[model samples]
Target: MVEPLPHVREIPPYVPGKPPPARPGLTSYKLSSNENPYPPLPGVLAAAEQAVASMNRYPDMGCALLYDALAAKLGVQVDQLAAGTGSVALIYHLLSAYCGPGDEVVHAWRSFEAYPIAVTAAGAAGVKVPVTADGRHDLDAMAAAITERTKVVLVCTPNNPTGPALTHAEVATFVAAVPAHVVVVVDEAYLEFVRMADPVDGLALVRDHANVVLLRTFSKAYGLAGLRVGYAVAAPEIAGALRAVALPFGVSSVAQAAAVASLAAEDELLARVDGLVAERARMVAGITAAGWWVPEPQGNFVWLGVGDRAAELAAAAGDVGLALRPFAGEGVRVSVGEAEATDRLLHLLGSLEPPS
Candidate 1:
């Protein structure tokens, strides 16, 4: 007999950014993953180095120091916060905690690629609501889609691939309308880049609403993607549920140290985020000026509806020494890199030929 669950065969594996080339030649820019172009700040590096010296010891399974630091910074109680390897792990833990066969998890189409994957892995059905033409989540549509089976609603603001962030009013309405039994997760991976007026204040929701959970990541603004540390702020009960589902010591010792030190260097990190915002604007302006259909990119990347020419354009960009993430048959995502990477992308765009 086949000694495994039959459903596992039908599951598609998650695909991250395309792997870098073997040799370090001038062929890849890795504008696919929305990682910060900056390196870990000085304080974070120092912390990591100190932790490295103690690698022989297992990390603090409780992540006590990191938890205290996060609580102080976010103005939450220690019981209200839980850390993970990254917010992605938190997402998975959330699903495992609350979703099972016959349960449903809701998310927007074309948002984070991992949402549906995590839902399916947990043996739950994924209900993907379509976004508006402007690419913002149609909260009402999502609310309408919910039924008794709905266990969680995942909302990503300044949504990935597409750019518009849901205003505070919009998110509040959605949260209010969703069924009381459903947990609403505001995945604010890119929240630090957003300077939008009336931004979605997830922390406030977590404090006031028992069903709300705020997932934030150090991978984005703090420039620690490689180390992998992120957290969720929720009601104490909900946080406990998440903790129950998470593996012990899931976060590395070095990751914890770096995350705590990074918190101390918030100003420096925000300055880098500010630079990225400026660079995002530049990427948008250049792409739009080229007459390509670029989305209103609010994140650290730009999405182009390049249609059938997407692969051709990506190839051209690669030939001229730029790497881009191609998706579907019509879309290409270009992460905002440093000045040199951005310059190369603009130059490559200028040299590309129209679809034949």
Candidate 2:
């Protein structure tokens, strides 16, 4: 039997949020993945369906229409954008382009699970900086963790699984502190859901600093998770490098068409995002009113730092026909799903003792 590289052998597999199990007499909701509960808009769905008619033909390698739509929407040059199967894939591409064996990638732990996976896959060492007790990234600590070997630094605003988002001033100051040679990646997969004051202007960061890259996805807000459309905005030089390493025709024609249609109907799609934001507020309020302390959530999910009770709470949710993501010995991440799901979760939490 052939053996894989030692680095690949040691890499931990990514665990995605699971779907709810079937129940005999109850409705089940999958709130484990931080996904948009709403279905795609009629226009977006139609665009995807139309694209499906040409299934025999290969997709455009350059993703021309998608790039055009994105450039117009973001006010960025076409050469400065690189699209991929998902933002997660783009992460891998950027890391592969910049990092080699012994190079370091600094990121907040308990943040996006993909960071370490992608970092390790690029044959780079991951410098895991622990997040704050409030589930926010310790930007100062992250900056201090940087070394001469550091090549890439990731900042996940409204971080996944965790709930807190970094403020503009906070990230801007941190960016200024880092050396100019290191690449700063602002992973804004949850940007559309953020409702906080002084949110980080990722595009501005990219404009001001050639080393900064902004990663955005259509999955969370545009209800395009299944389509797997995401893009990165960077200086043309970095963007070109990412594009160079990207998988050929990684994004399918259907996905491109759906993404373009979604952009054209951004107003309607964002309205759905507004609904999820309101639902997130409701979940936070209910949890707080019940005397439970959770990090202030700005994304479409809430973090319950239940420590050892994480698995226990997740099991209870599963028993009630709801699925939630849990990190053993840490906490459970509950995505703000349908109203019924939120109500069911609140009822379950109210019945149990809050985590100490």
Q: Write the per-residue lDDT of candidate 2 for residues 88-137, one digit (tens) a residue.
A: 99999999999999999999988999898999999999999999989999
Lowest summed lDDT window (length 10), candidate 2? 17-26
Compose the digit string of candidate 1's lDDT tens values, residues 153-261: 9999879877778889889888988877799999999898887779999988876678999999999899999999999999998899999989987899999999999
Model 1: lowest-lDDT 10 consecutive positions: 19-28
- Error in Å for residue 240 of model 1: 0.3
Score candidate 2 by TM-score against the native. Answer: 0.99
lDDT of 2 at 349: 92
The residue ranges of model 1 lying beyond 4 angstroms of the native Cα positions read 20-28, 353-356
Clash numbers, per candidate: 2, 0
TM-score of 1: 0.95
Could you estimate the TM-score for every candidate?
0.95, 0.99
